[model samples]
Target: MLIGYTRVSTDDQHLDNQRSALRAAGCQRIYEEKISGAKRARPELNKLLDHMREGDVLVATRLDRLALATRDLLELAEILNRAGVGLRSLGEPWADTTSPSGKMVLTVFSGIAEFERSLIAERTTAGRLAAKSKGIRFGRPPKLSAEQIALGHRLSSEGTSVREVARMLNCHHATLYRAIGTYITPADSN
Candidate 1:
């Protein structure tokens, strides 16, 4: 059994061409979807996978139609292999998991994709380090400056209520407590 899967990114896009091609390629049952490939969940694709069994073949018009990312494509291939099902792409002959050459090609592609991901990670880390060296700070700025925090501590120590200190500093009582490293106890407030 050759089960076909076709997808278009948007509702406005048509699946006629993919449908005709899948039909021509001898697909017995076809599942069509109009959804973004970037999305992880596709109802029609899930249904097609569930419907497939051992000795069944899954066909797609193109590799992009099945998955946008290399990792996703490899994962789907692994799932099919584990289930004793084969994956075939009409546009990409090397993606046919049923043949030895196709398997070899897929392995090589996986390696390349992994290498690319490592390179990206290295570049991002280096970029962040460079920015930090240039005195560029990340994340939210402190709510209170050092001078403001010292003033808050002084006011709290002088029997001022947390709410009154917070109002004087133009910040919340929680922020004032965090800045001063202490809350005003009932004895201190008195």
Candidate 2:
């Protein structure tokens, strides 16, 4: 079974090209949606995934149209691969997971993607460090005073939740979390 999944970001974005290409590619049952790929919840995508079975193949027009983020793309591929279901894309001939050669190609591509991400991370870290050397302060200015920090610690020492502390301080959860890396939680406070 060749199950095709087509997507359009907006109502104005035409899915004609994708639909036509998938049909030409011999897709019998096509599932489609017009929604943002950034959305974590896609009804049609979910349905397509749920419908896929072993020996069945999932088809898409392009990698980007299929997944919003690289992590999401890889995760979806991992799921399909583990389920013995194949994923094929029209835009990337080398990304066809339906054939042995396609599988090899995809393996190589994954290596390349990992290498690229590492290089990008190194470049970004170097750039940030270089700018900081010239007296460019990174991250947000400290909004919490010593008294507030002490209050947070005191409340945290008690039974107050981190959420309550954050709400009282008008700070992000991560900000307070990083500030107090491993504080005694309710379970650990005893």
* Candidate 1 positional error at 153, Å: 2.9
Candidate 2: worst-modelled 10 consecutive residues by lDDT: 178-187
* Full-model lDDT for every candidate: 0.90, 0.85
Model 1, span 7-102: residue lDDT tens:
999999999999999999999999999999988799999999999999999999999999998889888888898899999999989889889999
* Deviation in Å, model 2, residue 7 alpha carbon: 0.6
Model 2 misplaced stretches (Cα beyond 4 Å): 112-190
Best by TM-score: 1
Colliding pairs, model 2: none
Q: TM-score of each candidate?
A: 0.70, 0.60
lDDT of model 2, residue 16:
89
